[model samples]
Target: MPYIEVIHPDEAEGRLRRIYDRVTGPGGQVDNVLQIHSLRPHTLEGHMALYKSVLHHPRNDLPKWFLEAIGVLVSLLNDCSYCARHHAAGMKRQMSGDTEKYEGCLEQLHRDHPGEPFSDAEQAALEYARKLTIAPGFVVVADLTPMREAGYGDGEIFEVNQVAAYFAYANRTVTGLGVHTEGEALGLFPPDGEEWRHG
Candidate 1:
């Protein structure tokens, strides 16, 4: 149960109803994270827009699965089971055809150790995420050297940073609000063929 009342999709009106429709079109279900912002529907709208732009934008330099991996890592570092479990499921869905890789990634995250299963770039990115999430003040320009060497340009680096930073905010929101997963998770794949529109 959530700390506050969440507006169910079926009972939403106006903007909230429209956003819920987009999130649960063709029989999809609304996750608790979105419901947390139900009291302020515009915030929910903003949240979804930022999420899609960061993780689902077509021009994103990093793969969706990799971004999801970062989300899981940050959530775990924060000890946020809600975000971790949800993103882990999303990561699993992204790697659906290759169960081995998905399981390997989860195991690596669980151990808090980056090993052979992940590429050098992924390792570097994960390290950056760990430091940023746990100690943002300690993050210096030199911290990005490995990522640059791993072939990530300035824009890609920014994207990774933003994703990690966003999740930190999201994880805190879920934790502070005592939000529960309630057996509801967002879909692993993008909705509406990759083009998200605002109402």
Candidate 2:
């Protein structure tokens, strides 16, 4: 159970209802994390504001899909199952329900060899995310040159890094707050197809 009693969608009001509409509009459904947030609407509002500012920042060029992928990866590293599943659902939606590609990204990185088949850019990015999520103090100038060599400008790399950093905070908050999961929502994803194979 959550630290505070989570409110149902029908019961939310004031700022909570407004935030809920923003999060779950156009036939969208609220996730358990949002339900948990219904207990403290102001913090939820602040979170949504931060999320929007980072995700839709005008100067950023990183595709939302790539940023979301990094978020899933970071969530996995953080061992936050709710975030992992939620971000994976977002990635699935962004990938047009390409579950294979989403899972393939994970399989590729799990290779036994030190340097696997991923591109220099992808490898550098994964390494950077790992370092930032696992050990922030160790991230340094030496770690960033690879991203630069991979053609990411300073601003772009900063955006990527900040997204990774932010998700680490998100993962902890969601987990610590006892956010629930609806694994069935993952059924919306399938390996392939116009109609979902599962769910």
Candidate 3:
């Protein structure tokens, strides 16, 4: 349950009801994170749009699994287990349940350093995310050099930046609001495809 009052999916009406329809999982389930914005449905719409554009859209060139991994790392850094668990499940699904890859990502999430299973480019991106999340004000233009040296194009660099920043925003949203996964379908993802997938 969230700290603030929220309109349950079933009890919603008008604009909120319509938005609920688009994001509900099987059995009309909605993540508490989404419901946190129930008092202001427009913000939920904005959040959904930003989430899709940065982390789940088809045009994003960065690997989807990597994006989800970034989400996990950021959530962990912010101590937002609500997102960490959900996205770890999403990452596993994205990798098609490859145990080795999933475990590797789990291990990698514990530290922000470059290591086995992650390419040089990926390490640099992870480092960037760490700095951006831990201390965004300290991030300088030179910080992007490592990613550029590792062969990431400006577009791909932008993708990494957005994922880190977006997850940080999501983390604050979850932690600050006292949100939880009490009844959420942990692995259901990409918002519009909400369903009760076991995680």
The residue-by-residue lDDT of candidate 3 on 1-199, one tens digit each, is 5788989887999999988887877677788888899999999988887887887777888888899988888889999999999999888888886889789878988875746688899888989998999999999999999999999999999999999999988999999989999867776775333321222
User: What are the RMSD figures for all models against the true structure?
Assistant: 2.6, 5.9, 2.6
User: TM-score winner among the candidates?
Assistant: 3
Query: Model 1, which residues run further than 4 Å from truth?
Result: 25-28, 185-187, 192-199
For model 2, residues 18-109, the per-residue Cα lDDT tens digits are 77765663235666665677767887777655565555455568766566667777887888888777666666676766667767765653
Better of 1 and 3 by lDDT: 3
Error of 2 at 155 (Å): 1.4
Please state the error at residue 185 of candidate 3 in Å.
1.7
- Clashes within 3 Å, all models in order: 0, 0, 0
Best by lDDT: 3
**lDDT score for candidate 1 against the true structure:** 0.81
For residues 1-199, could you state the per-residue lDDT of candidate 1 as single tens digits?
Answer: 7778888877899988888777763346777787789999989878887888887787888888889899999999998998899888878777756889988888888766576588998889898988998899999999999999998899989888989988998999899888887766444445434444321
List the pairs of residues colliding in candidate 1: none
How well does candidate 3 score on lDDT at residue 156? 95
Cα error, residue 10 of model 1, in Å, equals 2.3
